[model samples]
Structures are given as structure tokens and as C-alpha cells.
Target: MAEAQEDEKVGGFLGWIERTGNKLPDPVVIFFYLALVLIAISVVCALAGLTALHPTQVNADGNPLVVMSQSLLSGENIAKFWVEMTKTFSHFHPLGYVLVVMLGAGVAERSGLFGAAMRAALGNAPKVILTPMVALIAMIANHAADAAYVVMIPLAGIMFHAAGRHPIAGIAAAFAGVSGGFSANILPGQLDVLLFGITEIAVEGSQLDPSWTMNVAGNWWFIFVLTFIYLPVIWYVTDKIIEPRLAKTPFSNTASADESVQDPSAKLSSNEKKGLNRAGLALLLVVGVWLVMTFGPGTPLIDEPACPAAVEAEGQCAAVQRLAPFFKSLVGGFMVLFLGAGWAYGSAVGTVKNHRDLVSMMAEGMRDMGYYLVLAFAAAHFVALFNWSNLGLIFAIHGAAGIEASGLPLPIAMGLIVLLSATLNLFVGSASAKWALLAPVLVPMLMLLGVSPEGATAIYRVGDGATNIITPLMVYFPLVLVFARRWSKDFGLGSLTAMMIPYSVWMLVTGLLLVVLWVFLGLDLGPAAPIAYSLPGN
Candidate 1:
């Protein structure tokens, strides 16, 4: 009853958000509509003589180059768009990254390697520390990306119920860690490659820093710190606030016996134990191969000749420049890691028998990605249209000029970015799609303000993650509600959102402060990723 009252109070505002968000078109449709809008806007801007001085480019006379808006409706651009449509979608930077990672991830998940690993991590955890343990594992489970949602959340409920605690509280804790702390992983993974790849495109398109390239670990340190910061937040919210509120609510297991949910506290089968042991060994071997390629006789992953003369003048190549090849190779490394580890586990557990089974697993993964492929097609065209329109760069330059003229402090500027991203996440749930749209403008705008591309990406991540739990638009929100309903059949959207509001509120506040502090301290976001950038030749 108390929970219901609380839900009503929180529902007033968030309910409106839910309704409005639901009315919005599908993300793919939104991108298609946005591309149409960009075309119309470009036509007007081109006619109105819209232009911005290119920050890094100069004409033959050594004057700043004038970037003019190009009308998408013009004859040449229309032909170019149709001619390059296939190439544009196929070459979309994040397309291959996500697909490749998911190929291996599909095998690991279907082979039960991912599920077994998550269960083993949380199964034996002590009750006193179960909340934090669940929180930590949930965050780390993001390496498995969306697969974590299906495997971890339900298992958490079972573990909590077995421990004589409210299962809803366990689900809340895991959900909070997984979605609310989406960007707070201890190590870089597929998301790193995806977001940074987009960042690279934004940089290249802006022509701001030709030397700038994507680093998968760009936000490594920031996210590493975020993991520890978010763990206690989840722990305290679950144990003290959410659980006590739910203590009066009656608990019932409404799920049928045949449901796939498992009692993780139960002992593992002999074959499962053997599979886990083999999976670990296989993962180690994969890492060893990468190490050998990186450090062996030829140093295959090192680009010695690509080192900058500026760094050479300092007597050594910068660590970032030296390891550029290695960093890029992480994409393939992750694919191989998941594939090899999963194949080993499957072989041990009899889920896989030979190369034919492996080929089948890869195909299944691609089939699951059909929706993403469609969405990517729309998003790729939208980005391509935006770049051709010149509005993205124009708006960025003018916006940066306004900021510069107003003398807004860099920290405050970044804080506003976090707020903007949080607001937008309520409407668009796909992180990659959201970043693809925002990166072109935000990355270049922040770069003009002397902020690094990685810094801009980090700030956006903080906002993108914190609001994910409260928003019904998030793709996983309804799925998580189903998990919650297995325990409390009467639970509604309002109830779940209300329960998660505290986690979202506290996380947003903590994340904003951390980002501001990072800016003030002038800290490195990751290896060779500084919080500030100076325009070349400045």
C-alpha cells in the first residue's frame, strides 16, 4: 500500500514522460524522419547563405576556409546520395564493430558459458554483501552486452529469494547496476569500440584534428572509477531504501515451474564445472595469443614508423601512438576471446561438436541482429545526410563561438552536456544511435572549446546511463518489468519506476559531480586521452 502511494506521487511526472516517449516514433523511424528534416533544413540554410569558418582548414591563400551549407535537394547531392547509399550503410563505423562482437557473444551466451559464469559469481555470495556483489557482477556482465539482461537479472532474483530476502530487491539491485551504471564497466568492451568508432567519424568529418583517432579505452579510467562509485550507491539504495519499502509487500512466486529461471544457489553439475574450468583456460590462451602478437619478436601490433616527429624529438614515441595498432586490434581480440572461450565451454558441455556448430552459432547471432541492421541503415543515412548538409558543423561552430563569447566555464559547459544527454535518453534508448546523432555536433562543439573528443564522449556517457532506469523508453525496461512481475504479480510500470527513481537520482547527481571534478582536475580520461585538447597549429 505504501509502495502504491509512493508510485502515484512519482508517477505524475514520469507517467507523462512514459506516454510522450511511447508516442515518439521508433528510433529507426526517428532517424529516417530526422534525415528528412535535415534535408529541408539544409535547403533553407543553403539558400540563406549559411556558413562557418573552418577551424582547422585554410584556403590556398592561407585564410580560414569558409564551409558553406550544401543543399541536399540540389542535383549533385541527390545523385551522390543515391549513388552512395549502399556504401554509406555498409561502411557505417559501428556496424561491423557490433556485429563482429555479437557473433562471438552469441556463441558464449548460447553455449551457456556467460550464464554459468554469472551464476557462479553470485551463487555463493554471503547475504551480508550480496547486494554489492550483485551490483559488481552486474556491471562487469556488461561485457556480454544485452545478453546480460536475460541471464543476470532473473538469476539475481532467485539468489535473493534463496537467501531469504525480497526477490524484488535483488532484481532492483541488478537492474540498477546493469542499466543505470551502463557506462561504468571496469574494462573496455564492445561499447567502447562502438562509441569511439563513432567519435572517430565525428572528428574526421569536422576536420578539427586530423591526427585524432579512436581509442577503444578512451574512457577507461573514468569508467573504472565510476564502477566503484556506483557499487555503493546500488548497495545502499537496495538494502536501506528499496528493500524496506517492499518489506510490507507480500511476496509470491507467480512464475510457473517450467520457467527457465534457475535456483543459482543449487550446486553446479559435474559437466558444468568442467565446462567452466575449460572456458577459463580457453580465455587465458586467447589472451596469451594477443600478448604474443603484441610483445614478441616483431612487435606486430606496434606501429613504430607512425610515431610523430614531435614525440620523436622528445626521444620516444608517445604511448598512445606506439600502441595504436594494439588498441585497434582489441576489436578482433574480443571477438576471438568470446569465440574461443565459448567454443571450449560448449565442447566440454556438448553444446558444440565441430566447425559446423560454430558456423551455425555465428549465423544465429546475425539473424538476431536483423533489427539492428535495419536501424543502422536508417541511422547511417541520417548521419550521412547531416554531414553533407553542413549544418552539423555550422551549428557546432556558431554554438562554440557563442559559448566562447559568453565565457562559460568549461566545467559548467560539460555539466550542461550531461544534462542534455540525460534528457535525450528519455526519448531515444539506443545508445549507439543517440551517440551517432549527438556526436557530430557535440564532439566538434566541445573540441572548439578546447575539450578533447574523449572528454565529450565521457560526459555524454554519464548522462546517457543515469536516466536509463527511470525511462520506460529504454529497450530493456519492459523486459525487466517482466522479470519483476515473476515475483510481484501486481507490480506496475509506476511501481518499478518509482522504486528505481532513487537509484537514478543519486546516480545522476554523483555522475555529474564526478564529470565536473574530472574537468576541474584536468585528469586523463584514459591512456593518452586528456580532458583538454588544443587545436593543431595553435
Candidate 2:
């Protein structure tokens, strides 16, 4: 059968989406265009002396700050720009994250481990349950931080292919749950630490209780509820909408339909089953080693606070901060886990006859990243230049201030916090960094209006998670595109963004409603954390 035109098959709004989206330039070129546009914007703003109050930033005397734009064409910056070109590309976080994960992931793929496991367990995984499972797992994967992007996403795509479905749908499902539902994990994690820590700094001189604590799990119950609400939406979009549209368009990057496995539901061979059993053992061994390393020594895997006396006396942390090192170390943990699992399965099944095969497998994985590396370089430049220009910070401050000036109802104000966070998330990809900027403004302002600081923090979480899937400026955005490209090499940035816009919009609207209702119900955000704020005398 001929490859059908995507726009022709999807009628009405979807067709218009496909048509308009496909008209945009390739992702690489688009980044370059964005860089130029950013430079122009930065220069204009700098000339106009447009500035904003830097919320968390302080000077030598520790007063709040006024941040001005950094003009790209200024003599000082223009010279520094040429000097930092190599450093910009090299320092981009996703560049390193993806490359490192692939070092092991590539081995897993080439060693025939993923294939055999798919044959063994893949055939048994119910197609109907796949979307929900991927969505749920992706949401919880925030515990592993950046590893979700590397491990779960590609694994989702492969599983989809084995199950005879569009692999991009699998990527979308995982991406939605992982990035789009980022704040909705059942487990409270370092994200809780990072954001609440900023919240603490935001309230330093406020009139409320000087000793009021900032709990890491303050939003735990709220986010826990959010996870369930998000799961069904992700399932519906991936299964009901995206995949059906995708089925009409053949994946251009992968093997032809006939050349691909026709009977994806084929039963596993006895040997493959045995290999899977060993793979499970290998995975357990990896986890076991990490556990032993964590508890076997004098808390070697976890970092002990230097000021333990001070920490405990503050009545904070909700628990100890000993897991900081372990949390920080998960990136490496994921690498070793994949490397060990792949090697174990490969050895059990004879795919790896010797150590040389492992070496070759690792190399093959890095080799596949050639296109991704180029894309990352351009994206890094775009992001770095944007950061250097300080437009992102200015834009965020402007957005936050606009909502405050609107004098909307408290519920509406909360919703705008979500919206502002979502919008700024596009420009400044770091969750902690953005929160650091907004917390001082949002948390205090909300408190004066009788919205708990925790409540304000929770609303920010909603906004940050909503639009993550749609933004290319997100450090992980290019990484996700590479995941989609594996199944459809012709899939462009616009294609990914277009497919994701529905998810973003739905998540945003649904999330807004959830926040409004949660506040109305006067639910406890977590232990001792309330939906309302109060002043001492009032």
C-alpha cells in the first residue's frame, strides 16, 4: 500500500493541524531561527531598558534585585559569545544525559536482549493495558529523575512496535505521564525538596510564624490524587486519538510493513523464556547491589547533613535528608542497571559470546545518536543564548505580575499561577530554577490572600507539568524527538508538538479544574498543610 498523506486522512481540525504543522521547517533549522529571533528580541529589550524584579536573587546586601536584559549584540557579550560556543554545546544537560543512557541502552538494543524479552514477555502484555501501564509507570518514574526520558520512553516505543502499534504513540504516552504529569507522582521526591526549599527562602522576612515549616511532602496527597486523574487522559489520547491517526500513516524511518514482524503476538520460544528469567535475576542483582551499597556501609550512598543539629532543631525535613546522595546518584544507577540487565540477558541467550560483543553493542548505541548530537548542539546554542540574554527571566516576572494585577478571584489567581508556570516552563526548562524565581513573588502574595504557601506551590506544580510535552526549549524536548524519530525518521519537531498540543491543552484545562475543586473542598495538601493561609492577628 502507498504511504497515505497524513493531512488527507485526518479531517477537520486535525487535518488543519497536520497541514499547518508539517509546513514548519525542520527542528534543526527551527532552532537556528529561534536563536536569531531571541537575539533580536534581547537587543530590542535591552535598548528599551525593560527589566523586572528578580524574585529570589539578591545582591551583596541581600535585598531583592532588579534584573536587566543582556544584549546579545553588546560588545562585551558579542566577544564572550564566540568564546563560549564549544562550552555551550558541551554543557547542555540533555546532551550528556542521552549520550550516557544510550551508552548502556545501545548495548541493550544491539545484544538482542530487548528483542528476546519482547518475544518472551511482550506477547503476553495486553494491548489494552499497555497505555495505562506506560502512563502510570511514567508518572512514578519521577523518582528516577532524568532516567525516565532515557529508559522508559524508548522501552515504551519498542514495546509498542512489538505489540503491533505505532511506536510514536508509545513515546507520547510515556512522555505525557513522565514530563506532562511530572508533579503527580505518588511518591514525594527531590522535586518536593527543591521546590519547597525555594519556598522557604521566599518567606524569610514574612509576617507569618517565623518558625513555620516547609515540608517536602506538603503537596503529597494533592499530587497523589492528580496521578489518577492524569492516567485516564493519557490513556485516552494515546489509545483513542493519536494511535488511530498514526495507523493511517506508515512509519518512514523503520522497516517496511512486510519486512517488520507481521505476527507481533507470536508466542515466545522456550529459550527466550529462560533468558527472560535470567534477565530478571540480573535486574534484581543490580538493585540488590545498590541496596547493599546504600545500607551496607555507614550510609555511604546517602549524604549526611553537616548541620544535623540545626536541621533537627528546625522541626523540618519531615524526615532525614540522608537520601540526597542516592537521589543524586540515580543517573549513574540507571546506566549500570541497563548495562547489567542487557549483558545478563545477552550472555544467557548467546547474543554475547564474549566481552567484545558488549563493547560493539555499546558503540552501536552511541553511533545511533549521531543525528541527536547535531540536534542537541543547535538546541544548546539556542537555549544558552536565550539564557545569556536573560529574556526568559524577564518574561517569567512579567507573566507573574500580570496575573496579580488582574485582581481575579483567589481560585482564578491560583489557576493563573498554573498557567504562568506552564508558559514560563517553555522558556526556562528547569523546574527548581523557575520555582526559585516565582516562589518569592507567588508564595508571599498568595499567603497575604489567605492561600497557603504550600497551596501556591501546588498550583505551580500543575502549570509546570501541563505544557512540558509541547515545548521544544525544554532540555529533554530534543531527546524526545529522537525517540519518535526512531519509529518515524521523517517526524519533525512540529509533528511532535502538534501531536502533543491536545495532551497539553487537556492536561492544562483538567489540571486547572482539579486545582479549583481541591481548594473549594478545603482538602489538606499533606500533613499539617492546609488549603488556606492566615495572618497572626487577623
What do the candidate models score in CA lDDT, each in turn? 0.88, 0.72
Cα lDDT tens digits for candidate 1, 1-538: 7764454343477988987998998998888788888899999999999999998889999999999999999998999899998999888888988888888988988888988889889987988899999999999998887768988998898888888899999999999998999999999887888888788878877888887767888899999999999999999999999999999877786552426787688788888889999999999999899899899888899887777677788865556778888888888888888999899999988899898998899899889999989988888888888888888889999999999899989899899999999999988988888998999999999999989999999999999999999998898988898888788767878888989999999999999999999999999999888988888877
Candidate 2 structure lDDT: 0.72
Minimum summed lDDT over a 10-residue window in model 1 is located at 3-12
TM-score result, candidate 2? 0.63
Instruction: Mark the regions of model 1 whose C-alpha exceeds 4 Å error after superposition.
Output: 1-11, 253-258, 308-311, 315-317
> What tens digits encode model 2's per-residue C-alpha lDDT throughout 163-219?
777888888998998899999988665467556655654554332345455566678
Clashing pairs in 2: none
TM-score of each: 0.96, 0.63
